[model samples]
Target: MHVVSARERLLTAALDLFAEHGVSGTSLQMIADRLGVTKAAVYHQFQSKDDIVLAVIDPALNRLGPIADEAEAQRGNAARREQVLAGVVDLVVGFRKVSATLSFDPVVMRLVRAHPALRNLQRIRRLLGGTAPDPGSRVRMAVIAGGLMMAGADPAVTGLDDEDFRDHLLAAGRRILKG
Candidate 1:
């Protein structure tokens, strides 16, 4: 069995609570209660819920870091562009369940909107920035990200498991690029 640290436990617990209850609905007390610890112990691990929020999100965003590298390395190649798009989709889809909830959460969105790291996020965005076909690229990017997130958790895509969803998404992506 893998022994988990308090930090990992806090992150897992935070994601669960935030998914069930939006960020505002959740509290350190709830997280501590879930872990059978006191709020102070939770605080000792993280100074604030916002800190925990960042911690939970950091892992997902970090995946994009590499996509940024791949994008820069490939420069202006069509293949490279597709690779970046495919990779971004794969990363989000890889964490579909949590990503789904986080993607839709108002608090998460608000925090991301106000995050000091906004400029830093631009680096990752720049990686796949050119993939957007036109002005609608923003909407398309959201759809692609949200699609991956929701598709990961979608039950109606019944025959579609994560792997299946990814395959379909990648195909859809190719089609999106072509037409």
Candidate 2:
């Protein structure tokens, strides 16, 4: 059954390919083949590979706002810290297949750096502070974000099912946040 629009199908396929192969490695032809369409058809929806990459990343990027807001709304420092960690864990675990790519892919990382939606990184840092004038807080936030991406992509973690993995990842994130 046809479950989604053509653009959605293209985005989905491009995301899968981008995850498997870095943006530099994925081609429009591969995306077309995944959707059983021609390269021209894919082009009809997106002007360039970069456009498809941006679109495929939009959903995940869209998630950062709510996460930042949820963490920022908390009353206490500890509460805010925990919320930030939880939101990050959910974001990473929810987008496990693409999380690593989002973190490490040069193309995606460049786009993210330019994208306005991700400006919330500053707010996320403020919310996850370690101590006043906290130099460690920034590093802590980076570690948590980077660690989740690496862990999610790690083959060793795959032996556990999704629920188990999610549980373990969340646990590890909590420990990381505490230390």
Model 1 misplaced regions, further than 4 Å: 116-159
Candidate 1 colliding pairs: none
Per-residue C-alpha lDDT of model 2 across residues 50-165, encoded as one tens digit per residue = 89888877777788888889988889988987887778777767777676555678998788889988777667767767434666665666787677757877767756677787
Tens digit of per-residue lDDT, candidate 1, span 1-179:
99999899889988999879978999899999999999999989889988898888777666666776776677475756677777866875677757656877777777777765555346654454534557677766556545554665565665666687778878876666444
lDDT of 2: 0.79
Question: What does each candidate score in C-alpha RMSD?
Answer: 3.0, 2.5
**Model 2 deviation from the true structure expressed as Cα RMSD, one decimal place:** 2.5
Task: Identify the leading candidate in terms of lDDT.
Answer: 2
Which residue runs of candidate 2 sit more than 4 Å off their true CA positions? 130-138
Between which residue pairs do clashes occur in model 2? none
**Model 2 per-residue lDDT at 31:** 91
Each candidate structure's TM-score, on Cα atoms with residue i matched to residue i, is 0.80, 0.84
